[model samples]
Target: MPENPVDPPGLDLARLRAHLDRELPGTVQGPLDAELIEGGRSNLTYVLTDGTGRWVLRRPPLGHVLATAHDMGREHRVMTALGGTGVPVPGTLLLDPGTETLGAPWYLMDFVPGTAHRDAAPLAGLGAPRVHAIGERLVDTLAALHRIDPAAVGLADFGRPDGYLERQLRRWSTQLAASRSRELPGVDRLHGLLAARLPESPVPALVHGDYRLDNVLVDEHDAVAAVLDWEMSTLGDPLTDVGLLVMYTELAGVGGGIIPSAATAPGFPSAGELVARYAGLTGREAADLDWYVAFASFKLAVVAEGIHYRFRQGSTLGAGFERAGEIAPVLAEHGLTTLKER
Candidate 1:
């Protein structure tokens, strides 16, 4: 593990213990062992454990943030609402919306026990036949998410449906404008093209804001245990979710020589297979997916730019921060290519 310690603020052990005693009662016994579990520039997630009991504490990064963003209570509510819907999410146990409890709004959920593969290196050499099954299951899980009725899940009030694409275009444009780092030339053009080529969405579905391999947890049996990270999730066009899933297909391309064994197996389907399966399951045509693909690319570019800006301010470490600046151009290129094809 890296030696650099993350300065996770507002996580007072004594306060958390008091809250647990008042809220959870008997769920967690013994002393809690909380450690920083991979934090990005945005939120802080800690893996808390006590004997056989484990839970995850998620809260906004220490400091200011957009009003609508990083609301732990909202995240917790969404997770709790989606329980038993076959979406494969961590079980939400307690939610503390007021900052009085943890210095910031936060929630505790059952720490899903599984391997979160961020890269393809470890997955490739595992030599497990269940990898293929897990891959298929991953696709199926996404299909299930896209098929979920946001209204039924109480997320109809989550996000605005009308002008959703327009709002996204403007949001990214604003982020691009506010960016302090070097701006990519293709980004503005991509945004313009996206605005002009917006397509009609059939219906809004529950879209996992970041639907990628790293956000998914796979158990020892190669089963997807949970879909982690719900910060960006909302009711939106299902195609957006599909496009994001496709955009990160290269995750399995990591480690150069070692690819997920499922990619080569006869029975296992590729990323394209997953998209086709989504179409098959939802009975929706895949022709309009290009626009969503472009949208996904553009959206990610905006997010990457935010990290790049923070890195320049000396708030974050690692060469990956500098590398993040490159994502905008690549994503812009992808968006342009998708638009041209359309």
Candidate 2:
């Protein structure tokens, strides 16, 4: 067992080292050091090093975890299944389902080196052509992901795709209800409008539920290195992912400094361009994406509300949580306007 001078919150370094030694011997050659990675609102991510090798570990949040929200096994299984596919994902190394070691199920994967640009300033310095190319590649990668057959990747049973959009609406509504603390104007109306106008979903594909520029890591050559954060991945209406991407890009700076976005940087593709590029690559009709975008806005509003709830309850970890509440109403208003315009 490695000496533990200090263990970061939500991690037990000595037990983790012992488990690693037992599961995969000699993986750790020296003292293990870990630091919790910030900016994660759901799963707790950490970067670990043993003076030789570096890896990443993910686990559920420390306290007040929802029953089905943070499934470590699901994340591991999806990434492992997509290993051979064109989608770039971190190579999963091990999954510990039992809670004996870390008090919760956790998994580790190779830490791919790249930059996850969350803000627009750095990307603005990258010049317009490079940023534009990166944006195009981002869309192209998403198209490739949507083109994959779930069964071919051993993920046919990953999630039930039938009526995915409808179920998604219900799920988020329940989530919002669970986290509701104060009245949010327009949220209920947005939800009602979405329920009244659910579009016919196209053929389902494996969807990265939260697809955005920052969720992916880009390499020096401006290619996507690996897509990160698969807690939300499932077999669903692929356009839901597209709509989320478009929403993030469109609402880049509207989060009151709570939501970080690189999409607003100079040379990044416009929301319209991104939608068109995705349509061109996947040959899917994007004409009826207005509803999808509106739903995306509503979904994000729910998520922001959830975060605000946690913050108010004093259960949220890290900085900038207090500002999350401000974004919910803004997103709800945007969602309402989107539906009204259609």
Candidate 3:
């Protein structure tokens, strides 16, 4: 691991060491080394190791605060609550909600060993059978999540379930307004269409705000080892989670074209198969999925536009952000076309 003695852009090693020492007692020993984990577009993540001990830390992005966007405590609380269930979240060791520790709220969790398949290339050599199984596991795991009772798991107060679809449309629209670097073509039209076609959500369940192959970790046995990136997890329409998963599965290039993914791996489950599987497992109605997919596209558009806004303001942390703005228009166009077909 590369060592930067100075405080890195998102993490202050000295301060972090002090807090870990104060809060965790003897969890960390010797000097602390922190490495910023790239590829996260929203909250900042870092890997910390003190010679023998290792853990992962999550905090908000450096600048351009968006209300309810990079919430550290919300993410931590959801993970902590879900631990008692079948969900495979990292074990929470500490949560520093106040800024007195390292100038921002952060949480430390046990970094379990698994691979987050970000793109298709990583699973290429695993052959079609394993890739197909990976896709099946992804959908099944989502079904598992949707089956959990939020109240039973102590997450009933996470978010309001009534009028979730309506509130989501308004919420993303507000996010767009907050990050409006420039007028995005078709965004407003897409939002209006989504609002005009809000579907009756099934019984509210625990929804992983961003549900995709990359957001999960797959182990050597081709099973989903852990579900990650709970920054957006909340109580809402479960179909929205399926809709987002459907958007990411690329079967023979027929699905989402925004980014190449393990979903495109040979023999990976088709969007239809994933939808059917989730429906079969959880027995939840999937009829209103088209509207949900369109909504997912709208949500992604606003999220991309926000990243673009931060990039323009020089607030983003990693590379490839220069092209983040380019995805919003494409997503919006897809959203419009998706709704038109229904």
Candidate 3 residue lDDT tens string, 88-205: 8889999988897677788899887898887677787899989889989988888889888888988879999999889888888998999997979999999988888788888889
Model 2 residue 148 lDDT score: 96
Poorest 10 consecutive residues by lDDT, candidate 3: 250-259
Model 1 spans with C-alpha error above 4 angstroms: 1-10, 39-41, 127-129, 250-268, 316-319
Candidate RMSDs in order = 4.0, 1.7, 2.0
| Candidate 1 per-residue C-alpha lDDT over 181-273 given as tens digits, one digit per residue, 9 for 90 to 100 | 675868888888888888887787777888766678888878889998888877777778787777666333422312222244333456677
Candidate 1: count of backbone clashes, pairs at least 3 residues apart or interchain: 0
Worst 10 residues of 2 by lDDT: 253-262
Best by TM-score: 2
Clashing pairs in 2: none
* Per-structure clash totals for the candidates: 0, 0, 0
Residue 155 alpha-carbon offset, candidate 1, angstroms: 3.1
Residue 254, model 2: lDDT of 72
Candidate 2: misplaced stretches above 4 Å? 1-5
